[model samples]
Target chain A: MDLTLKIWRQASSKVKGQFVNYQVQNISAEASFLEMLDILNESLVAKGEEPVAFDHDCREGICGACSLYINGRPHGPDRGITTCQMHMRNFKHGETIIIEPWRAKPFPVIKDLMVDRSSFDEIIQAGGFVSVRTGGIPDANSIPIPRRNAELAMDAAACIGCGACVAACKNASAMLFVSAKVSQFALLPQGRIEAQERVQRMVAKMDELGFGNCTNTYACEAECPKEISVSNIARMNREFLSAKLISHKEF
Target chain B: MGKSLTYSSITKKIIMSLAGLFLISFLLVHLGINLLILFDNTYESFNTAAHFMATNPLIQTFQWVLFIGFIIHIIYGIIVQLQNWSARPVRYMKKGYSELSFFSKFMIHTGVVVFIFLIIHFANFFIVAKFGHVDEVTYKSGTYENLGAVVVETFKIGWYVAFYVVALLLLGFHLEHGIQSAFQSLGINHWRYTPVIKRIGTLLSILITLGFIAIPLVIYFS
Candidate 1:
């Protein structure tokens, strides 16, 4: 199979860039999307040209590193799948694929398709952890959490910090991302200790990091590979308001 | 004060929602008066009401309050938008797409157009009635006249009617998203009733906006 590629190429964050086109010939339809790109890079290397640079670790899609916006949809046209999981069969022969990096203000480009998602990491570091110290692994049933609540916590914990929610948001808000983390912790027993402070600190950090406010658009949920619900956002809002009400001075 | 400032974004949205609901009430009242214009014999009665709205001290005070409300709402919206823009300073390179509902994405754009429309609407009707020339047509009772003729004449013009219809359409679109989201932002989502509440919100927004829009269209075509 043959494919026409229009990939964004930028030398450095300081320089302006544009789409550079390439043709990849003799590709297998069964190849994963990233594998097709790997073939393209191999060809480029053979011709003594600079290879296309993109982020990927576990090409199996769990690492949240293989971020790519294919055509206009995030992680390609499929729902609840990452770029690495996206298959080349999703494209047709002689198709012109327009690929670019995520276009949010917070996620800056590092090289050809890599972005600095450390802002997300910074937000996580702000308060995304439980304060409970590691002693002996506490008895599994030591803390009583309702089964439903535990399930919800696990669901919220499913967020992989992919920054896809940010790219999906029109306002570029990180509310969904922050809310998921907050909700996950707020739902569990160990997390209840610092729940109030955690939400306050995380929300503050989210705002401080320049993430946009949630407009309740639910677009983040729609484009999320994890299929995280917007209801988590609602829960976060309730928790934030409740926390703020309790300690007017703390937050 | 610090707490208020910290929660100012949500607070401002609350204020916007309150002011919007107030404006929606005013639309109902305006619609009632305009409906009177549909009856040629009752046109004078509608004019009499308009005169009261224009000149009565109580109504004048209310008008001032409404003006303040509008200013606050608009300024707050601008502030929220600016803060949002500053938060995300970098653009994404991956060109990811969102599955955002149509009304959500277009709120700001629709809001801007509606704001412009309000300016023109006030200039035409409110300002004109207060400060511009009023050629009153004598009532059937043969006593006197008011500004009903001016309103009818203005609506008769193709451009005025067109502009008004377009503006009202924008308002309808704005309300469709604004009403339900307002409730959600205020934490009104309950398991059994939230969907129903959202539906009601959608209906009210559509009905009120269409009601306002229908008035001018009816007068123009009739």
Candidate 2:
């Protein structure tokens, strides 16, 4: 397949970026989107030109490293898969593929198609964990968690920390991501101990980082590669409200 | 602990949801009261209801509450919308092709239309009944401002009725998304009940729109 790629190009975070078109010919339809980019980069490097830069790790898709907005979707035209998992066959023979980075205030573009997502780290650091005293791995049966709760927790835990929710959201809201992180614990017994504090701190951090508010658009759910449900957001809202109202926690 | 709840994004949505829900309730009552006009050509039942609403202290107090709800809903909607606009400083050259819910995306636009309609609606009825001189009608119970007559007369105009119909339909669209979205924001989402809530929201929006539209069409025709 021959494809025309309109990839965003930028030198640094402080510089302006614009779409630069390049044509890649004789490409296999089975090539993953990232591999296609690699082919383009190899030719660029051969010509002594700078290759388009993007973020990727664990090309198998669980690492949440590859963030590419292809053809107006967070992970190209494919559904429920990362950019690395999206194969070239999803496109036509001579399709004009537009690729860009996640555009959000928190995720600033570092270079072509690569945006810094340390803001996610800061949000997680705010309180995305339980501060359990280290001990021998406890027997799984000790908690006596219901099967429904565990399944729900695992579902929320499926988030790979990708910024597709924010990128797909019209408001660039991180509600879906933060809510998934919050629900991963709020649904379980062990994580319930610090649930109040976790929701408040993480929400405050998300708000402080200049992420937009969720307006229930559900675009995040639609674009999520992990197929994370928006129900977690409602759960987070419930948790946050209870934390602020019932719990006697200070700022 | 020191953070204000008002500043939190979730809390802001909670506020919007609470206010929106209150307004939605008000619409049901408003529709009921307006439906009285269609009962008879004499318009006595509607006039009495309007007079009671205008004079009853509790209803008057609730009116203020309703007004405040509208004010908060509008103000917070604009604030959150502006913040959302600024969140993504850069625009993608290609528009998204995701199958997002169409009504949810244009809420602010539909809301603005409803707000503009409210101003025109207020000028036609509220201001006239409250401050401006409106003709009075006498009933067996008492005499009061004949607001029903104003409604009937207003709807008699072809263009005004057209505008009213259009505005109500837009309001319906707003309510369709707003109702379910409000429930979701209030943390009422559940697998067992969310689908039901969404259906109820759509049904209620349609009923309200059609109910309100009936008045103008009936008044104009009769």
Candidate 3:
């Protein structure tokens, strides 16, 4: 199939970027979105031109490394899949596809179709962990965990740390991302010890990094590659409120 | 930027929601009191209710508290709006606005219109009752200023009635989004009750809007 591509081009973080048009033809519908891009890059290299730069690790959806905003949605028009998992068949033949990086104040553009999501890392570093003793691994079934609780923890753990929530948010809010991290621990007994401190510190870090506040738009859940529920955000809110109310110390 | 408001965005929202909820209660009381005019055509009950509301010491202090609540609500709203606008400096090239709710997208827009209406409303009624004076007429029991008459005369003008009704409808829009959003912001959100809260919020907003609209309609037509 023939495709028209408008990809964002930027040489460096300090420079301004703009969309550049390119054309690719005779591509297989079975080829993945990244594979289509690979074909485009091969042609660019053959023409002695700089190929479009994007981030992708595992071709599977697990890595959460494929970050691209295709046709206004994160990871293209498809729901519940990252860029690497999207096949070219989703686009009609002769369609013009606009591809760009995630846009948010915290996730600044690194190059073409790539934005630095280290803000997510910083937020996680702030408190997305439990203070467990470093020793031999405890038996997995040692703790009496409810099935509902374990399922919720696993559900919240599905967050890919993708910045789609921020990019999709009007205010660039990181509430969805932060909330997922908070819920992953809050639902589990192992993480209950520092739950209060973890929520407070991580939320503090998220705010300090210039991420916008959540207005409950639910865009994060809509564009999520993992289809992570916004209910995690609700849970996080409950945790934050409880933590703020019970604690005496001020951040 | 006030250090005391708390640095956490959710806390700021929670505080603003407290003010919003306070103001919502004030709306109900005000609505109930004003509703007296619709039933008592002779204006006795309405005027007496107004007199009591004016002279009662408890209600008087609450009026001031209501004013403070309004101040806090308006100021916090502005602060959050400023912060939100500044958070994203560069706009998206192809913004998928459909990704956001209509309520979320135009909160500030409806809020600004409602704020302007509030200023006009105060100038029309509150300022006149406080600083200026309305003519009084002797009733069956005692001599009482006919505040309801004042309302009727004001609504007699077609344009004023139109403006009043439109503004109240805008207030309805603001309240619809605000009431539920406030709950979500305050962390009262849960799967079991959040949808219930949203529906109640919408119903309450519509009722309040119609309640305010009914007064002007009854005044003008009857």
Candidate 4:
């Protein structure tokens, strides 16, 4: 199968970019989308053109590195899937695919389709971890966690920091991402020790990074490759309110 | 006040809800007055009621209060938007999908559009009737024919009624998210009661928005 691709080409963060068209022939329907891109790159290299630069590591979708907004939808018109996991079979032969990097303000274009997602790293670094120190290898059964709470924590922990929520958001809000991180920690007993500080620091970092306010638009959840629940956002809100209330009283 | 400022996003949304609900109340009062036009002799009574509302000192005071509320609500909304805009100066570059609802994703867009529509509405209806040239019509009493006649004439223009209905539709879309989220933001969510409250909010939003739309259509066609 052959396909026409209009992929965004940007040399650097400062350079203005636009979609440049390329045609690839003999694409296998069974080939994964990234593999097709690989084929395109090989063709480009042979033709003495710069290979399109896109981010990918664990092509299995766990890394959340491959982010592409194909056509108008993110992750190429698929539900509950990452870009690397999307297959060429989704597109027909001779189809024109419009590929662009995530259009959120926080994730600036580094080159081609790759974007600087380090803002997510900074948000996580702000307070994504529990302050509890590891002394000795503690018994897992020592801490009693409610089954429901454990499950909820695990669900919140499922967020891969893909920034899809930000991309999918019309206002480009990162509340869903920040909330998931906050809720994951807030739900656990170990996380409770630093809950107040964690939420405060992380939320402040999120605000400082310039993510939009969450208006309860679940676009983030919908576009999340991990299928993170919007309920995490609710939980985060509850936690933030409680944290602020408690901290104020003490001060 | 410091704590309130810290939670300004939630506080601002609460202010939006208060203003929105107040506007909803005003709508009910306006609807009651308009319903009187259905009766042949009650037109004068309706005019009397409207005249009193326009001229009464208390009502005038309340009207100023309403204006302030509107300004605060819209200004706060814009502030929130600008804050979000500055926060994410770039779009997301990741390619993936999740399960967010359509209404949730487009709330801001719908809200901004509705805000523009509102400005047009106020300029046409509120500004024109209050300050523009309006003829006095005498029936059972001397009432300015300005308000009702202006509304009727505006609806007579096909584009005016069309814009109004479109604006009402946007309002409906805005309420779809605003009503339920307002409760959530206020921490009113209880396991059993949240669903019930959400349903009521949806129903009220639909009815009020549709009712407002219906008025223009009825006036235009009738």
How do the residues A1-251 of candidate 1 rate in per-residue lDDT, one tens digit apiece?
Answer: 89999999988889987899999898887898999999999999999999988989998778889887788777887889888888888889999998877767778888888888999988889889987656788887888899999998999888888888887777778878888899898998788888888888888877776777777788788888888888787777777777878865665
Q: Over the stretch B79-182, how does candidate 1's per-residue lDDT look in tens digits?
A: 67777667656554444466566787777778898899889888988888878777676666543246677777888989888988888888887777877777
What is the overall TM-score of model 3 with all chains considered together? 0.95
Of models 1 and 2, which has the larger TM-score? 2
Error of 2 at B97 (Å): 2.7
On TM-score, the candidate that comes out on top is 2
- Model 4: residue A86 alpha-carbon error in angstroms: 1.8
Compute each candidate's TM-score over C-alphas: 0.89, 0.97, 0.95, 0.82
Error of 4 at A50 (Å): 2.1
Angstrom error of the Cα, residue B52, model 1: value is: 5.4
The model with the greatest DockQ is 2
Candidate 3 Cα errors over 4 Å, as ranges: B97-100, B218-222
Residue A148's lDDT within candidate 1 is 94
The total of clashing pairs for model 3 equals 0
Q: Please write out the lDDT profile of model 4 over residues B127-208, one tens digit for every residue.
A: 8777788777777466456466666678789988887788778777777777787666654656698789779878977887
Per-residue CA lDDT of model 2 for B147-168, tens digit only, reads: 8788888888999999999999
Error of 1 at B155 (Å): 1.4
* TM-score of model 1 (CA atoms): 0.89
Q: Between 2 and 3, whose DockQ is larger?
A: 2
